[model samples]
Target: MQMNEEKDSPAARTVAALVARARAAQQVAEGYDQQRVDELVAAAGWAIMEPARNRALAELAVADTGIGNVDDKVRKNHRKTLGLLRDLQGARSVGVIHEDADKGITEIARPVGVVCAVTPSTNPAATPANKIINALKGSNAVIVAPSPKGWSTCAQLIAHIHAQFDRIGAPRDLVQCLPAPVDKASTHELMRQCDLVVATGSQANVRAAYTCGTPAFGVGAGNVASIVDETADAELAAERIVLSKTFDNATSCSSENSLVAVASAAEPLLAALCARGAWLLGAARKAELAQLMWPEGRLSPAVIGQSATRIAEKMAAREGAGRPEWQAIATARPSMLIVEEDDFGEDHPYSGEKLSPVIALYRVADFAQAADTVRQLYAYQGAGHSVGLHSARPERALALGLRLPVSRVILNQPHCIATGGSFDNGLPFSLSMGCGTWGGNNFSDNLNYRHYLNVTRVSQPIPEQVPSEREIFGSFFDKYGTA
Candidate 1:
C-alpha cells in the first residue's frame, strides 16, 4: 500500500488534512448524539468479536514477529478487552460527567476532534481497540500508528473495527490506521497534525510526540519491584509473586523485577515458592541463569517469554555441561530465581524490567532495609506508577504509599494483575499504564476508553448569591466545631 505523502511533510497541509477530516466528522458526529454513539459502540459486535480478534491477533503476531506465544497472546487480548469494556460501561462521558446544583453549573462532555493514537508491539490489539472505543465514547475520530512489530495485528483489528462501523452505518474514516510503518518521520508528522496524541510504548516515540507541540499523553519505562517482610504471609506472598512473574510471560510493566525479602522470612518464602513450582537457584546456578538472560550483556529475544525448562536447557547446552540432568533441570525452574550479590543495584545487569519469566531476589537485614531496598528500586524507575507490598502491617503499607513517588500501591496482591485492572483497585482497567511523576505523566492511567477522548467545558454564567458569614459558619462549622 502506498503511504500518504502528506504524512511526510511537516507543513500546514498535513495539519489541514487531519483538521478537515475532524471538522467533517464533528458536524456529522454531533448530530448523531451521544446515546446513538453509545448504542452503536455497545452493539457493534465488538464484545462478541473479541474472541475472534484475539485469535487473529495472536496468529498474525506470531507469524509476523516470531515473538510471544499464541496461547499467551490470546489470554492477554481477552483479559485486556474484558477489562477495558467493563471500565467503560458506566463512565459518564457524554451527558453530565459532573454537575453542581449549588453553583448552577454543569460540565457537559465534548469531543476534541481528532485523536492520533500510537500503539506498541507488546499489546497491539488491546491498545488499538482501547483507543477506538474511547474516541467513539466521546464522539471523536481517531487515527492509529501501530509499531512495526504490531502492524499485522493492528491492521486486523482496524479491519474488524471498520466492519463494525460499516454494519452500524458509522463514518468509515472515524477510525483509521496509517497504512505504513510508523517511522520517526511519519509519526512526527502525525503527532503534529492530530488534535491530541495518546502514545503508549517506546520512550523514543513518546519524546517525539511531546516535541511535536501537540497535547500528548505518554508513558515511561517500568522496573517495578516488590517487598515481602516478616510481617507478611510468606506462603501467599510467594505464590502471588510466581503468578505475577509468569503471567503472560511477564510482559506487563507492573511485573515484579525484584523481590526484596527480610532475612527472617527469606528461607520460608523461598521454600513456599518451591512448593508452587518455582525453582530457587543457588549462587552459582543464579549466575548461569543471568548469563542466559543477558547473553553478551543484552537480553536474548529467544529466552524472552520461554518456559523455565527451555531457558535451563539452552543455558546448559551453552555451558557444554552435557545436558545438565533433565529431571534436575525440570524440577529446577531457572527462569525465576534469586540473583547473586554481584547484581544488586542500578549497575546490576538484570535490575530493570525483564519481559521474560525472571526475577531478582534480594535478602534484606530488616524491615528498614526492605523499605530502603524498595526505595532504591523505585529510584531506578520512579513513581507515577505503582508498587507492590506483601506486608500485613497496615502502617507499613500506608508508609510506603506516602513515601513512594508512585500513585497506586497494591497490597498483598499480584502486582501485574492488579496494577492495570478494576477488580480491586478503583482505577480503570487498561493495557497501557501511565507512570505518573516517576514515569513523567500527569496521572498513572491504565489507558482506558476515557483517556482517548478530551473534555471541553461548557459554561453559562449564573447570578451569584452572596452568603452571610454566619450562614456559612452555621452550616459547616456549627455541625462540627460546636458539637
Candidate 2:
C-alpha cells in the first residue's frame, strides 16, 4: 500500500511521465551512428548559440534569477557552446572506438541512457546547454532539473532545442526540462528515476545527487586563491585577475575568491588593481561589509551575486544607521572591493567562496608562504577545485600543481576563463569542475563529453607475457630484500 501510494504521488507522477518519454527517446538514439549523433549534438549547440536566441535566454536568466548581467551571460552562452562544439568536432562516441592487436582487445562506446541534470540559477542557460550537447553527442537523452529561479530560462531553452530537433527530424523528447512546478520533490524524483545524475549547483544538491541511488557526477565548492609572486608582471596579473573577478559579478564558481600576493609584489599589484577601479576597504568598512554580506551566518541574497555598485549601495543604506561614513566610499563606483585579512576558517567568513565582485587580499612574505597560505585556505574550503598562479617562472606553477590538493593550476591567465577550458588552454570547456576526493567529488577534471558515455572492452585470448618475480621486484629485492 505504501509503495503504491508513493508511486502515485504528484512528484512521482511528474517524474515518471518525463522519464518515460526520455527513456523512449534514448532507446531510439541507441541506433544512431556517430554521424547521426554528431548531427543531433550540432543541432542542440546551434539552438543555444544562435545570436538572437542566445540573447533572449541571457536576458531571461538575468531578469528571472537576478544572479548575473545579460551581457556576460550572452558572451558565456556563445563562447562556452562554441568551445564545446569545437572540442567535439572529431571525437567519437559510437561504435568501435579502439582496437589493439597486441592486447587482443576491442573497446566499444555505449550510451549511459537517460540523464538527469540539476543546474544552478547562476548559469541557467549555459550549464544545461552544455549538458544537453554532451548527452546528445553520446546518443543519450537529457532532462534538466533547474533551480526555481532558473525554470523559465531552462523552459525557453528546451523549447528552442525542441524546435531545432524538429527541423533535424530528431526526437523532441530527447532534451527536456521539468515543467512549471519545479520543486525539490520533483527534482528528487527525477534524480531517483534517471540512469545517471550530473549536478552542478549548491553543495546540498550535489550531495543529494550522490545519495540519489544512481550513478552521479557532481562538482564542489570553489574558493579559488590566486598567487601573484614577485616574478609576475604585476600590471598584467592585476588586469587579468580584475577582469575575471568582476565577470558576470563573479557568478562563476571558478572566479577568484582570494588573492595571496608575495610581499615584494604586493604593493605594485595592489596599486595596479586600484588603478583598474578596485576600492580597498578600510578596517571598519571591511567589518561593515562582512556584516552586510553575512548577517545571519550565511551570505545574504541581497549581495550574493550583485555588482559592486549594488553592493556599495546596500552598504551605504545600512538599516537604522542613517548613511554611515561609507557614503563617500560608495560614491567611488568601484568595479570590485578588496578586503585584506590574515585569518581563515569558519570564523573568518572572507576565507570561503564569496560568489560576488569581492576579493580577499592576503599578503605573504614570499612564494613559500603564499603556497602555505593557499593550503590553509583550502583546508577551510574549496579543496581540489583549482588555483591560479601569476609568475614568469613556470616552475612555480608546476610546484603548486604538485604540492596543492587541486585539480587545475591556472597559470598566468584569468582563473575563471582558464580553469574551465579555454581556446588558448587545454582544459576541457565546461562549467562543472569536479574537485576530486578533497572536495567530495568523483572526478578531478573538468566535465566533458567523455563523462557522458560508458565503454565496453572485449578481450580475446592472447599469448601471456607475464613478468618474472625477479623482473617485477628486482630493485625492491636489491634495496630492501623482499620476503
Candidate 3:
C-alpha cells in the first residue's frame, strides 16, 4: 500500500499480500532442513557484522525516536542479544525432535507458520530482536507491527536483519515487518490471517489480538509495587530501589511504581535514601512533583527524560506564585518519593504506573500490612506482571511470594533488573512480562522461545497380557499391605 493511503483504503489488501508471501515462505521452510534454522541463528551471532548491527540499532533508535539516549539503548540491545543467544544455544526444536523408547512414538516440532508480532516503543530494538530470534528458534516466520513512535527504528532494525539473512544465504522472508503503519483495520486483517499473534504493548493492542480468535501470547500493564520490611537493611534496600527506578529512567514495566515499607523501618529507610541521593518530598513538595509528572492531570512529555534541575525549573515557572522554595536539590534525582499512610486504596491515583522515575511510598503497620498494601496496589493494576521484596527474613519473603498475585516476585534485588534478567528466576530475560492469573494470561512468565513452541506427549499402551489374580495380590500385598 502507498504510505499516504488512508486506513480504510486497501490496507487489508496490502496485509493480505504480505500474508500470502509469508505463507509461501512457510511452505519453503517446511521443505528445508530444520537444522538450517539453528545454523542461521548461530551464524548471525558469530557474524562480524553483529556489532555493527548493534551500533546501527542504537544510533537509529535515538536519532529516529528522540526518546531515550543512545548509549543506554546500545547497552539494552547488546545485553538482550547476548542473553538470548546464551539462553537458547543447544536447545532443540525440529521434526521428530523427541522420542520415547518405551512409548514407541516420537514428538515432532512443527512451525506455527506465520506470526503477527506487535511491539512497544519503550524498547523497540530489543523487543523486535527478541521476537525474531525466538520465532526463528521455533521455526516460525514473523511479521512485526511496531508502534508508530518506534517504526523508523524498527525499520532500520529489519534492514539489519535482512542484511544478516543475505550474508547467510537464508530466506529473506523468514522474518519481515509491516512496511507501513498498521491501524485497527490493518492490524485486524493481519491477526485474522496469521497463524499466531504475539503482542506486547498497550491494552488496546492486546485486547485486539485476543479478539482476533488466534492463539496469542501477550503481556498486560505493570504498576510494580515492592515491599521492604523492618528486617531489611536500609542501605541495601535504598541502593536497589535507586538502581531500579533510575535504570532507563524507569521506562521498564518491572520498575517499582511504589514502595510499601514497615512503619518502624520507614524513617530509617528514608534517612538511608536521602544519604543515597533520594529526595524525600514533604506534603507541599510532593504535590509539586505530582503536578510536574501529571500537568493538568495528564502525563507531561517534557518531563519524561529531563534532569532534576529541568523538572524543578518547569514546576517553579508553572506554579509562579511563590519563591519556588523547591529548588532542585542534589539529593533529588529525577525520581520522586512520597511517604503516605497505608489506608489509601487502589483508587488512589498514586498507585497507578508512572513510566517516568516517579515512586510512591506507603508506611504499613507491619509485614502483614505491607503485603496488604502491595495487594491494594496490585488491584489497581493487577499482577503488575511482577513484584519485589527486601527482607532478611526468609519467612517474610516467602510469605509475600505466596500471598501476592503477581507472576514473578523479585527478592532482595531491584525489581526492574531482577525480574527480567535473574538467572535463578528461570524467566527469559525480556522487557515485556506476561501477567498470569492476576494479569489474565495463561502463563505467569515472559513470552520467549519456549512459548513459541508447543509440546506433544507420546504415549503407548502396555502389552495386553493380564496378570494372574495370585500374582496381582502378591505384588499388591508385597508393596503395600502385608500378606
Candidate 4:
C-alpha cells in the first residue's frame, strides 16, 4: 500500500501508527506459550504491586481527576491488581485449556490480537493495570484509550507497564496508549482499527465500541439497589453499606445507590446507618440536598465523587447557589447521605445511580415489595447490572436472585466490593463488569483473561453414535402414536 500521510487527520494518524505498531507486536505475542504469557502478567502485576509505585499512581489519579481519596485509591490499585493475578493462577491460556476424550474434541486458547481497551476516569490506575494484565495474560497486545480526564494518570500507569516490559525484554509496542491530549476522534479511530475493543467507560464510549464494526466487550450501566429484609442484621448491613458507598467517594459504579427496606427494619436500619456515620436528610431538607446533587435534572459534576462533608458545605453555603433555609445536622459529618425515597419510577431522580455517597431509602411493606421496587429502579437506569440483598432466610435471597434481572445479585455483602470480586467471594476478579444484554452488553460475568482470548475447537475421528429416528421421536410418538 502507498502512503497518504498528509490526508489523515491528527487523530487518525495517531491511531493508525499506534494500531500498526500494536499489530506488529501482536504477531510476536501470538506465538507465546502459557509460561511466557504468565511471566509477562507477573512482571506487570508485581511492578504495580510495589507500595511506592502504587502510592504514586494513586496520588496522580486523585490529583488529575479531582475525585476520590488518595489513600483509598492506593488500596484499590493494590488489592484489585493483586486479586486478579491470584484468580488467574494456573488458568491456562496456552494450547488445550480443555480436552474431552469422550466427545473427541479439544479446545485451545489463542490471543485476540491488537485490543483497543478503553479505560474510565473513576478508577484510572486500577482499571488500566487490570486490563493490561488480562490482555498480556491472554498473549494479546493492547492499546489503552483512557478518558481525557484520566489521561495524565493513565499515561503514568502505562509508562510503568512499559518499564516492566523493558525489564522482561517484551515488545514495548505490545502496550500502547492514545497521546497526551485524548478526544472522541482519537478514541473512535482506535476502536475501529483494532481486532477487539474492550471499553470500560461511559455509555457513549460503549455504544461507540458496538458501532465500530469490531468485536467488543463493553461495560453496562449500574444503578445498584440494596434490599434489606426484616430478618437481616440491621447493624451489620449498615456497616457494609457505609464502607462500600463511601469508599473512594463512591467511584465504583457498583456502589449501593438505593435501599429498599421493610418498615420493621427501616427504623433500625436508619439508626444503624446513622451510627455508622450516615447523615439522614429529613423530608424538610430534601429539597436543599436535591438542589445541590441534581441541579437541573442532572448530577452535579462538583458533587460526584466528592466527600460528604464537602457536599454538606455546598448545601450550607450562605452566598452561592443552593442557599437553603436549613443546614444539615452540623455535627453529622457523614460518609454517606440518606434520603427518604418518594418513588422508584423515572419521575423520581434519587431512584437512579447518584455516583456519589447518596443513598435513597424506600420503606416497602415487605420483601416482595422491595424486590419489585428494585426491579423498577433498574428499569429506569441500571437494568441488568447488580443489586444487593440482605436476608437471614436463604430462600428469600434466592427468590430475589432468580427474579431480578441484575447479573450480580450480591448477597449479605457490600455491593461495591462483592459485585466486582473480593477475596471473600468465588467470582473471578475483574474491574470490567458486563451487565448482560438487559444492560446493553454482551456478557454477564466479570471480565477476565478468558474474555480476551479466542478459543479454537479441534475434532478427531470417532465411532458414530447417531440416534435413530425411533429413539429421537419416542416421546412424541408416545404422546400421539406415530403421526
Candidate 5:
C-alpha cells in the first residue's frame, strides 16, 4: 500500500520533479559500460564543436550575457572541448578502472549520482557545456543553474546536447537546468536536493552551496597579479600583459589586476605598454577613475566587462556633452588602460581585481620587494589562485614560487591564458579554477570530469610489512643514539 504525499510549494515541487527525473536518467546511465559512456560524451562534444554551430553559440553567448567576445569565446569552447577529449581518450571511469597486482588491490570508478552545476555569466556556454560533458562521462546526471543573464545561451547549449542524446536513445532529462527566472529560492531548493554541487560563480553562491548540506566544489574571486624583475624583458612582458588585461574586456577572473615592476624596469615597461595602444592615465586621471569606478568602496559593475574607451568615458568628470577626444578614444577603442599607483595594500582599491581592461601599476625597489608585494596582493584577495613572474634568474623564480601561497606561478607566460590551462603547460584544461582554503575552495587546480566521479577501492589479503620502531626511526637513532 502507498501513502499519500505531502503538498509542496512551487519551488520545492519544481526541484523535486527535476531531481526525480535526473535520478531515473542516472540509473539508466549507470548501466552503460566504459566505452558506451565515452562514445556518448564524444558525440555531444563533437556536436557542440561543429564549426558553424560553435561559432553561432559563441555569438549567442556574447549577445545574451554582454560579456566576453565572440571570437575568443569560440576559440575557448572548441579548444577546451578538444582538450577534454584528449584527456579522456584512454581513461577508464566505469566498472573496475584500476588494478594493482603487486598490492593485491583494485580501484573502481562509480557515478556520483546527480550533480548540480552553478554557472556564471562569463563563459556561460562554455562552462555549462564542459560540466555536462564531464558529468555524463562519469555516468552521472547534471542539472545546471545558469546566471539569469546567461539562461538563454545555456538553454540553447542544453538543447544541442539533448539533440545528441536523442540520436543515441539516451534520456533527455539527463541534463536539466532550472527553466527561467533562476531565482534564489529555486536555486537553493535545487542545491539542497542534488547529490553534489559544482558551484563556480560569486562567493555568496559558493558559500550557499557549502551550507546546503551537500558535498560541493567551488571557486573564488580573482585579483591576479604579476611581477616584473630587473632581468625581465620589459617589451615582451608589457606586450603580454596588455594583451591579457584587455582580452575579452578582462571578463576572465584570471586576468592580471596588478603589475609590480622593479624600479629600474618601470619606465621601460610603461613605454612598452604605451606602444601597445594602452591609454596611460596620469595621477589626476587615475584618481578620477578611482572615484568613478569605486564610488562607494565597491567596484561599479557599470564599468566592468566594457571596452577601454567606455571605461574612460565613465571617468570623464565633465557634466556637459562629452568632448571630441572622449568620442575619438571611444571610436578608436584603445586596447587597455594603464594607471600608476604606489600603494599595494588592501586599502588601495586599485590593487584589487577589476573585471575590465584595467591594470594597476606598482613600483618596487627590487625583485625581492616585488615578490613580497605579490604575496601582499594575494593575501588581500587572490590567495591560492595564481601569480605571474618574469625573470632571467631561475633561482629567483623558484624562490618566489616557494614563498607565495598561490598554486600556480606562471613564469614568462601570459597570466590570463596560462592560469587555467595552456598547451605549453601540464595542467588540465578547465574554466572553473579552484582557490583552495585561501579562497574557501577545496581544490587548488582546474575542475574537470575527474572531480565528478567517486572511487571504490577493493582490497585483497596480502602480506603485511609492519616495520619495527627501530627500523622506522633508524636515521634519527643513528644521529642521536638510542634512548
Candidate 6:
C-alpha cells in the first residue's frame, strides 16, 4: 500500500497530530542551553526512577503486559534509569561541544528533531523512559509507540513525564505517546513523520522502521549463548548465569538462552546451577516442555516470562490423566528450568530464544568445540548480538571476539546486565543494543544520548601540509617498486 493511502485513517491522523506537536516542542527545545537540557533530562529520569513512582509503573507494567514480575520490574526501572543518568551526567550535547586547534575545527551538537521510539512490552516502563531521557538530553522531543500489550503502562509513564514537565515549565508535548488503539499503521505513520526512529522490539517492527523511509535505529533479535570453559570457575559462572537467567523471569533480551560448557566443567557447573535453584529436567520432560513451550513452532505466549514453577505447573496440567511428575517439580519451587540438549538450530526449538526462565544446556569436548557450538548457534539466530565466556584464559575471549559474528564478548559477568551496560562495565547504559550490519542494523553500539544528537564540524583553512608522493608511498615503494 502507498504511504499516503492511509493519511486520512484514524491511526495515521493520530500519529500525524502527535508528530506535529512533537516537532513544535522540539523546536522550542532546540534553543535550550546545555544546563537546560541536563535539567530536563534529570527531571525525566527522576519521573521514572523515584521509588514510589517506579513501583507504581512497575506494578502497572506487569499488570498491563502480564509478562514480567512486579518486583524485578521495579528494580529494572530504578537501576536502568539511574545508570543512564549517571552516564549522562555532565555530558555536553549543546552548543560547542568539541574543538581542535591543530585541525582548526569546532564541533557543535544539535538535536535530530522529534524521535519516534518503538518500545517493547517486555520492558514497558524502563525502555520508554530511557528513550525519553536520551531524547531530552539531546534537546529532542520524543513520541513513544509502545507495543499493544504495553500501551497502558506507557500511557501512565507518559502521564508521569507530563507531570514532571509541568513542574519544570517544560511543554507537555515534549514527551508524548501514541493514543489508545495503537497499531502498526500508527507506528508506520509515526516513523514516516518523525525525523528519526529508534525501534527496540520485534524484528518485524525493526524492519518496518528501516523501510518507513526514515532515518532509523533498530535493534536485532536476541538469542544469547554463553560458554563455560574447563578453566572457568564453574561455581561462580553458574551463580552469575542463574542470577541473570532468573532475573525478571528472563524478560531481558540479553538473558542467556543457550549455555555451552566444556565436558570437564559440565558436572560441576550443573551441580552449582542446581544449588542455585536450577531444576534439571530429564530427557522425556525436556521433550514434553519443548512441545508445551513451542506449540506448532511458535513460542507459547502463556509461558513467556513465567516463573519456573509456573511453567512446570502448566506442563503438569497439559499432561492431564497421566502421572503428575511435573506437579511435583512445581511444588519444589525451582527458580529456573534447565534442559540438556545436543543440537542447535531451527529443528531444535530449545536452542533458540525462550523468553522465560528456561535455559538449554550443552556439553562440548573442549573450548574449541564450545566456541564452534556458539558460532553454529549464532548462524541459526542472534547474529551480531552478544556471547558470554566464563573462562580463566583471556585468549578464549579474544578468540571469540575475533572470530564470532557477535558484537560483544562479555567475560566473567552476567550476560543480561553486562551486554546492555553495568556500573562496572565500560559499555554505555542502554536498553536498546544495535546489532550492526551482521544483524541487518545500521549501528553497532549501545543506544545512548550520542545517537540522539546531530554533530556538525566547523572547519577552517589550515596551513598547507600535503605529503609528497615519496612520503605517502615510501613503505609501499620499498616493499615493491612503484611504476
Candidates 4 and 5 compared by lDDT, better number: 4
Write the residue-wise lDDT of candidate 6 on 5-39 in tens digits: 67777877788888888889889999988888888
TM-score of each: 0.86, 0.98, 0.87, 0.95, 0.94, 0.98
Give one digit per residue, the lDDT tens place, for model 2 in 296-404. 9998888867999888888788864335556665687788999998999878999999999999999999999999999999999999999999999999988999999
Which 10 consecutive residues of model 4 have the lowest summed lDDT? 321-330
Angstrom error at residue 197, model 4: 0.6
| Model 3 segments more than 4 A misplaced | 1-9, 32-34, 43-49, 101-105, 295-310, 321-323, 330-347, 423-425, 463-483
C-alpha positional error of residue 269 in candidate 2 after TM-score superposition, expressed in Å: 0.7
What are the runs in model 4 whose C-alpha is more than 4 Å off? Answer: 1-7, 318-331, 469-482
Clash counts for all predictions: 4, 0, 0, 0, 0, 0
Least lDDT summed over 10 consecutive residues: which range in candidate 1?
337-346
Model 1 C-alpha lDDT per residue in residues 99-163, reported as the tens digit of each score? 77667677777777788888887677767777777777777788888888788778877787777
Estimate, for each residue in 178-266, the C-alpha lDDT of model 3 and write its tens digit: 77674667777788778889998788898888888899887888788888898999999999998878776676778787889898888
What lDDT does each candidate get? Answer: 0.73, 0.93, 0.74, 0.86, 0.84, 0.91
**Candidate 6 local lDDT, residue 242:** 87
Local accuracy of candidate 4 as per-residue lDDT tens digits, 1-483 = 123443277878888899989889888888888888888898888777889999999898888888889999988889999899998888999888999998899999988888999999998889989999999988989999998989988888778878888998888898888997888888888888888999997899999999998999998987999999999999989988999999999989999999999889999999999888888777757766777777788887888888887777777773553345334453467788889985765567888888888889999999888888988888789988888988888787778768998788788998898878999998888888999998999999999988998999999988899999988998999899985
Please identify which of the two predictions, 1 or 3, would achieve the higher TM-score against the true structure.
Answer: 3
* lDDT leaderboard ranking: 2, 6, 4, 5, 3, 1
Displacement of residue 26 (Cα, Å) in model 1 is 4.8
Q: Which of the numbered candidates is closest to the native, going by highest lDDT?
A: 2
lDDT of 5: 0.84
Write model 5 residue lDDT over 1-483, tens digit each, in one string: 111232266887998899999999999999999888997798779767988889988998888877778888888889888887777788888989899988999999999999999999988888888888888889999999999998988888888888888888889888989979999878888888899999988888999999988999999879988898899999999888987888778988889999999999889988898888887776766776776678799888777788787776765534443445555555666888888876655578888888989888889999888888888887777888888887777677678778888777888888888877778877787888998787888888799888999999999988888999988999999999887
lDDT of 6: 0.91
